[model samples]
Target: MATSTPEELPSSAMTDEDYGAYRASAALWAGTSVLITDQQGKVLVQSVDYRDTRLLPGGAIDKGESPAHGAARELLEELGVHTVVDRGLAVDWVSADSSGAPAAMRFPGELIHVFDGGTWNDEQIAAIRLPESEITAVDFVAPARLPDLLSPADARRALAALRARINAAGTVLLENGHPIAPTSLDRAGILRTPRARHHFTFHTAPVPDTLALRQSWGWVFAPDGRILLLLEPDTGAPCLPGGTPEPHDHGDATTTLHREAIEEAAARIARTTYIGYLSDPAASCARARYAAVLTAVGAAPVDAATGRTYIRVLATPEQALQQFDWGPAAADQLAAVHQARHRLGIPRAAQQPVTELASPITW
Candidate 1:
């Protein structure tokens, strides 16, 4: 056997481009999906004859087309919607061999890309025309109904994509529709906390971004149209129940709300609606606010062991506005929560809100 010397070997043929071509030929399929929402935040979906479950307006990428371009092509073909794909929401990897998948499953693994389809107006939604050959019917599905409307895999991907759209922080990486890593900051949840104007009257020395912390403020409501407020054990001032996002919360705003609701007020949140984030330019911090409805499950112990006294009071919206001296900023946040609740059509009854209750309402 004769071994070729380094000088004699044809190094030019084994260039980086050649290696890239080889890697690209690996046994993997790529597909793209879009996340289009109506004015009400419902997702756009179509009933397909090829599969039992509904699908988002997308399909597998062509041999030489980019993912975004493929998504755009699919949108035009599937729903006759003409639009450009400019932003991506999430990237998910699906493995055919993992998770006890049956060997009989013949499909190869896939790399999935999800893009933002931008919210549409009623006129645009009504103008959509689906291809009769592929799509049977097109309709908008609410987030709560996705699990039942779409296949399990699709539901997970759609939910993650929807969340990413809300956050608008950046693209999310996922495996089997789940996040690849713990979230560091939730773009959707970060918001400025309402503060008194006096705090902003004089510019305090800039606080290093490193010193800034992520926090969650919850607007918990009880049955009979009343909001839950906490009386500060020391100052007797009224405030929302919340605190810093702990590592244990897994960077999830809902998890933080669940834990804080119970710890601070012994209150159980039956359901929570993310009202969006409020930014505090003064503090250089973000506050994720949620409007949650309490169930009959929680109780405020007269003397809980929090090393301080916490009084949980349920008050009507008007009462909350009158009683709490929540400076202008906080007051604005509270008002916004109410407005969001109204728009979401969440009633203040003791029953579950329009949205499904967050699981395990307790910590």
Candidate 2:
């Protein structure tokens, strides 16, 4: 086969740049952004004059500027905050596409860096300054509501970065707003559905053996002390694994816990301690919350009753709390779990993102 000569070769389809001044023509751009959150974990977003969708507060890196410094510069210019950001949270490789962008942007494929801007207090938030042009306004939004305000790709990217921050899972690399090897949060579909409200009365007393039992659930600490969290297969909501005593349970919460733990997570729990109970009049049942140390957690086996295996995660109490809406009682229950952990001599879990218990993830 004859090699094609330069005269017969076609020009590369790429972004117009360099004007043949230095290197081969190519379509590539670099930008930087910072993900800032308030003390309450709400993400800060900007509404700019050039686009209908809101975005993280950041902009293109100036020539000779490092991505980290560019992120800091953009933060200062856009928000009037002198905070310097350096920790990288995410790196997204956007594909080249100009069809949907503003005409003047040209839309070269971008290497976008997102840094952790850390949490800002109310006084800091109140001091925000906006320029006369570009960023028109700013808002701090709940993570679950991000999709409603940002572009689809942006929402996914933002949420993934947020989960990385929450997990302290280190910098996540991405392409077109998705992880290559999805994290536990992504695998279990965390935050895909809104957290449902739970109303109940939390009683600290050990549920008396005499009380007729209906439901049972509790925090099960792993060998490393992280609590076991299971996803509700239908709703994708996190739950403590337990249920009403079966005929074989003999009406004991501890016995019920043992059997339910096996069925729900393929876990064998030891050293069960009853911490409290919650009475949900709506459900007309009293659910006992206990704290137990895990003897072992096997690969998730298909639960005999439901036929669907569960998505299991190991979470710190704090991380687990964020995944559910228990109202004020959530705080109370969390306190009890900590107390139980203390009693059992289980050390607090180190800061990390919720991690999957290796198994055939039952979505």
Candidate 3:
């Protein structure tokens, strides 16, 4: 071909040999980690010798390596076990810190991929053999407690990843240590705040007249089968709507349920069906659990009892149950919601992430 002027050259025909800008991918660093949890839903973190902070069992990805390969390799090298680690739980893009040690250590910004390693039992945990260097110890820490123990970025990423796994829906994109737009689980501050456990003898009937009522709670349901859940800012623990019967309730459990449901969740429940009660004889009180239809859900207002607005959500029964530290009781609690839904002619809710009731949904 005839020699073509720089300006006359076709875009595709222009050669990088003369005027190409240097585009180097090497400027950015790449790291990989795995989200490994025990049966109790605690994340496994490694105590590395290079830093005071703890981190998930993962490290830098090497040249010519895919993130998955790097993660599997790191797991094999660090945990000393051959395992299949796939499924992207989260990918966090950390910006280059100017004054921080990373900049001084000759490090640039990083793109880290976190993959799901799934749940490991006691035997799998026992199988781990740490290397003689880098990692000193490994421990399974609660996701909420990760921030206290692990690095801030790692903590945020871990919590987000755990929530993603619980959501069982998709991957999360993050920057720094927070989600770009927090989901309902993130806004509720769950996985970071501990779940409250209710320990009592669960009954399949209404609170007995003989039992002194301590509080009333319900698995309030929407016509769509979603259950109404309430969260207080103090703990971010999801609880069924309802409370102790006040003098206003006139010693009626149903009355207490109706009033408290509106006050706590801004929800109006109709066609209530008593499912069961949680009898705590040691505390000399019983907490009644009922299943009711959500007739109307309004705006969440400041709860007079706590003086703080509660975070109201419409969650599947399973989502609500999994949030508690109930373990086996989670199954039974789910059963209670089922019994309520069944008797009330509401179908089981399709599995989904817990979502806030930002706007009113009236049936």
Candidate 3 lDDT over residue span 9-42, tens digit each: 4355445543332224335789998999887667
Q: Give the residue spans of candidate 1 off by over 4 A.
A: 1-25, 98-106, 184-363
Model 1, residue 227: displacement in angstroms? 16
For residues 1-363, could you state the per-residue lDDT of candidate 1 as single tens digits? 211443443356666565555555556889999988775456799899887889888999999999999999999999888899989999999877643545686657889999999889888888788886989998886565677878778887887777566434478898988777523122111111111222221111332345344777777775555566665544444467777778899877789888877777667776677775655677766567777777643545433335654655555554444333333454555566677567545664342111212223343
Which is the leading candidate under TM-score?
3
Candidate 3, which ten residues in sequence have the lowest lDDT sum? Answer: 17-26
* Candidate order, lDDT descending: 2, 3, 1
Candidate 1 yields a Cα-based lDDT of 0.66
TM-score of each: 0.50, 0.78, 0.86
Model 3: clashing residue pairs?
none
- Order of candidates by TM-score, top first? 3, 2, 1
Q: Indicate whether candidate 2 or candidate 3 has the larger TM-score.
A: 3
Q: Kindly report which residue stretches of model 3 are placed more than 4 angstroms away from their true locations once superposed.
A: 1-21, 102-104, 199-201, 205-211
The lDDT of model 2 is 0.80
RMSD, one per candidate, in order: 17.3, 6.2, 4.6
The models' CA-based lDDT, in order, is 0.66, 0.80, 0.80
